[model samples]
Target: MSDETMRWAPAVPAANHPGGALRRWASGWWSVVHLVLHPLALALHVTALVLLVTGTALVPVLGIGFLLLVPARLLVAAGAHLERYRLAAVLGVHVPASGPCPVTGAWWRQLVLDPRPWRRAGHLALVSTFGVIGAGVVLALAGTGLAALAAPAVSAGLGHAGEYSWPFGIPGTLHAPALLVAAAGVLLLALTPPVARAFTAVEVLTARALLGPGRGEREAVLRRRVETLTETRSRTVDSVEAERRRIERDLHDGPQQRLVSLAMQLGMAKRALDRGGPDAAREFLDAASSSASAAISDMRHVARGIHPPVLTDRGLDAAVSALAAASPVPVDVEVLLPAGGRPSPTAEAIAYFCVSEALTNTAKHARASRAVVQLWHEAAPGAGLLRLRVSDDGVGGAAPAGGSVADGGSGLRGLGDRLAAVDGWLHLDSPPGGPTVLEAAVPWTVGGDR
Candidate 1:
């Protein structure tokens, strides 16, 4: 699995193991004695697990009981609070203190009102039950060790009383069985932390599910999203302005000045027409008119290329229609939109030009039979969500650098930069051998202050 998949995998605690060779040897033999003690430890774990699961699962049932014991609700509430804290420590969960569950009139009524209180209550009750089991196991292990110390004396005919040689009337002459039991008890105590941590993890998960944050937190998240989108909008405007300046410079120096010189020559030719004969004047006039017309046409095309009038007046669907008609290849378009859901003018312009550029690339390079264009107002799961996309189908392996922007000589790099300025993104997916798709998404509301 990929890293993302692994990141969301569930937690599993590791089992405790001996740290060194002496400990390992002790543990190997300890296991033999532990067999005598395993049942008790196992019983503790099983009992605790069952209680924890049952109490949490039957929260609803206990909620009903709270209604009848309204007076003792404090005690019940206290017990739940302790369990929550203890569970946090045992399970090693780092959860915020939610404080006590509020007191409601009639314990049973309160329990019925909220399932969580009872669920937590149930878990606490189970923890208490498991606490008993764990204590019993410890006691059993201790008892076995104490009895083993006395066994030697009892076997020697001194009786159990004669074995009392140390503090608390306990014997310290370690025998095989007694030593083994003591070692096993130490191991069990050491393993408790891991067992507790597992339970704590479960509690953390349960609390997260049951006591999720309120509406205010959700609104705060939404606000952050808006803030991020606003920042994107500002960047988009800056990028667009930069692009405009670049295009203006390109035209002013290259086409615009050339057109101006062409107009001057045409004017001179017109003056010469007055002095020359009718035939010569006619040819000069024709050439002058041709040059003037060519320059005028070039300027007009440039102005239209800068920002198409169709896009401003007709919106994305209509503008894309105009582009489709102009494309060299047959293009099919499908658009579904609300009647009044017009994208902001800038977004519409960007989208129209983007589709225009993409389709132009497809027609010029992708050796495909047909192309499809789709436009729509799509909303994601949250509020304030609106987006548009354009896609195409043609020969695969088309990329901005390889075909569209590079070979076609359009500043598509500027187009991508413009989209980015608005917090929008452009995606191109094409693999060699036959179908290429391009997509772009931008916010509906204007991104920047422009």
Candidate 2:
């Protein structure tokens, strides 16, 4: 589909208006229960942080302080992780995990330089305070409501009307104080959900802001993407140029020469006919016919090299099946695409080429007796991806650019570049002397008719 037609629109949540007493009461009770646990969880978080900080300080003096620090930071991170899940569960707000931690450099250097750890620590500290306050407020509201609800029972048991007072000097009543207190209790209970929601929102927002991917990590991701794109762009340009040269060479050596010969034979036949030599003209015409057929066959082969007609006509499934059928060795093909679900033309073409190239490499170099090609669509929230896996039981010492395959040219690397053009990637797993698996994934969304 066109980008304009597939523009994204934000989804707004429908507001809940309590339509029944039962719903209000249940919501209030749920708030009271969760609010009671919120404080406990926060208290635990605070205690863990305190211990973590203290342990780090003491261990540093003992020369093992750095070792303790790493685990301490991890503990802090673990607590923050749990809090993120808790926020999602209790508050219905999802906070995704922070991006991967940098593990390449010295552990101490990475930990010290990375800001996420410190941000998580800060969140732990603040959540403790927020949790305490929320717990206190919820408990006070629930406790007061419960106390008011029990006033009538207490008064009846004592055989005398109990005195009850409302907030802000609303005045206590000895006569029918039970009714007044119960009414107050019901009011308090009704207000608890909104009040608890307000308090919980603070913690949820804090976790989302502090416990998720920070600005630094996001920028780092973008920078890496830029580098990848630059490399892929260069490779794509080189690949296109190499392909053009290849096609030129094919035409020069194959179809173009054949057509030239065919024209020469036709000229010779015309001359023989002019000389009234029927037998010589007939021989020349026969040769010319053979040359023309060879030329047509050579042109068809070149065209197939550019793009297989089957791929355009029948989609990825049929294209891949044709590839498997043509392989020198046995190939097992499995294609799992949903009915009525088709990837964009570009995606399908890329997938077909990747499989074709990989299978060619397998058949030519792997010396394997058999191979397998699997294709499937993976669906996600906003988009889908086409996943292809080609594996062969061949002598597995293949690298993208070097090794034995170096003589075979940079076909694998070119495939990677092709996939990268579509925001896809290629992964190669070829160990010393065993199976070699090539997997590629490309983003694809259902588009307008083929």
Candidate 3:
């Protein structure tokens, strides 16, 4: 059998077996209870809908009618919500709730524009028809079953000879007639559960069709998600290209030039040695060595910017602390990573770079006397998120868009794009005064051991 079929397969033996059949029959009877109650519940919904329709119609004539719109919409939504739950609990079918209506603009306009209310109204109208029919069928079956079951007592009370006719012309008299009637009653009772379940299945199908967000809504949601992802991807690519250019420029201006100078100095030192001037040779050699050392230092700084070793060795907590200590402004650092809970290396790297970039902006642009860095891991049920907050008491009005790195916009924008690459985000709250606060968060999965 397929996985789905196997999942729903009964644990008990086949229904042909006596005990299994009895169990099945018992379950069927239990389902009858829900069917009996269904119509009464539907009746209340129908009455409420009738009143709502009347009130809505009177809206232009009476201002009071406008006041009823909100409550009426809510009442309809409530009925649909209850029906969804009822279908799940009683019929073993789940129908998801509709997406929320737009709450902006006038309430009446919102109600009129929303498709859910009208959909629910139509559903209730159909349900009312179904309920009336279902109620009549159930009452007929139940009344016939009871009459058959008590035929002897009922006939005796009415002063008639006990007689029963079942299956067309098959007639019985006296005690035999009573037994036959009672058997018919037992059969009807046994059939009730399956009958009720069949009716409930139809109702659930109706509810699923009308009460949930339809296909158009789902498509719109998907389209919005696609657009958002596309924009993010574009920004990420731009940020990466900018970063690569910055790296190339840094290498050419700093380490690459130092290495070239060191080579020139080595060539000069070789010539001095050939000319047999020991002091001159030694001076050239020292200068060359100093140049080489400077080049190495510059390369190390570049490599650190790419991925800091401190972040890998000591986790985000220690890394952020080090960053704060090195800041031009006195920075207060608070790190709250769980003892054994550290984020994945990629996540940690992204977070570290984000903070590093933010601090760079704060120090260079924000002429702040003090700053604060807060880093912590928030553990939720199924996942954890790493949160970083950087605030500076500086000349504010900082934003993630507009201006260059020198003026402090590209850096923040780059940080945002970088965070986006790792499913992280950056939020900057800097009004045109002082105290700029930059907050960032990224999904974190606990790394093994460290």
Candidate 4:
């Protein structure tokens, strides 16, 4: 069998050697243990169900019994929790936990009205009731098989050769009948593992059906996700709009004014030249040239804010290195990304800006001497991720909700909004005293490899 299949499959047929047979049995031993423990689980489930039924019947007549529904529901939920753990530990079947029971108002209003508790009760009923049958058959078969296997030896050990015992009418000696019983015992032993595993699988399926989240809970989760996406998308749009307005404002204030001055200065220089005053025209030209250079520098700064030319030319590592070099505070930079391919352009931009903003925050607000910027790409649980970490040894206690000028919460909040644009995320961990760390990550794909 493939390794994946073998991981969950029951024991294979016994091998040639005793050791090999024992090893095979070891694989499915959990199944047998699970079956053996059914009585105890069945007791818990049955008690919960009894309370549920009794509470339901009594609540219609007297309100006093309505209180019993709370404990009943709690018991069933607890049993379901245990079932989840057991299934995961033994069968490796992970069932997602259902949402909690709604208890906003009266206990009867929530507990009796909600269908979730009923579903859990139904699962408990199915397992506890039908499970008894399977449990009985398995236990009986196992007990019978063990007795039959030992009958010949035990009978002979009694030192009676031909006297047949009354129990099951077996001959009390090592004869053909004894041999037949041993053969039957061997057949039942061979059948137990698969039988136990099959029962366990059925119980697991039932638990998943009723104990796991129901459709209402699933719809609630989807609704929550939609709400989150809506909020993030709105924030992303706002962030983009705010950025565009900032760029426009900066251009109007800086480069545009310089260029207007340049135009005025060149015009004066032309007028000076036309007046035949070479020295006056030469000074005007020099002032115009300086204005033009300043305008170019301002434009470059705005362009870097938009998307740095360095980031476009070099990869994320080199781009972040430039940021580190420019930061007022000393920054230790390290980038460990793939050489063959890189994250998508959007991801790289996010990383670059993340580093830039973090460094900016460190320099402006952190009041620290040193900081560190590290970026890397690695495989995550479900996909690949490009992660960035920026840490500073600064006075900590950064606020999460933004709008705190003292702690740079506003900038970090903007960082979060920016990351949410690409379904990325940012986490700021800054306690009191010192050492604040900002960790952010964005999912990436290998197809973007360089």
Q: TM-score for all predictions? A: 0.45, 0.66, 0.59, 0.58
Instruction: Point out the worst 10-residue segment of candidate 4 by lDDT.
Output: 399-408
Global lDDT of each candidate: 0.57, 0.77, 0.76, 0.80
Order of all candidates by lDDT, from best down to worst?
4, 2, 3, 1
Residue 412, model 1, lDDT:
57
The C-alpha stretches of model 2 lying farther than 4 A from their native spots are 1-44, 52-72, 83-114, 125-208, 277-280, 379-382, 400-408, 445-450
| 387-410: candidate 3 lDDT, tens digit per residue | 888999998878533323334478
Q: What lDDT score goes with residue 208 in model 3?
A: 82
Q: How well does candidate 3 match the true structure in TM-score terms?
A: 0.59
Deviation from native of the Cα of residue 318 in model 3, angstroms:
1.7
Superposed by TM-score, candidate 4 places the C-alpha of residue 5 at a distance from the truth, in angstroms, of 37
Cα lDDT of candidate 2 equals 0.77
Model 1's number of clashes is 17
Best by lDDT: 4
Backbone clashes under 3 angstroms, per model: 17, 4, 1, 3
Tens digit per residue, CA lDDT, model 4, 135-216: 7777888888998899778877887577536376643445776878899998887777778777877888888889888877
Name the lDDT value of residue 167 in candidate 4: 71
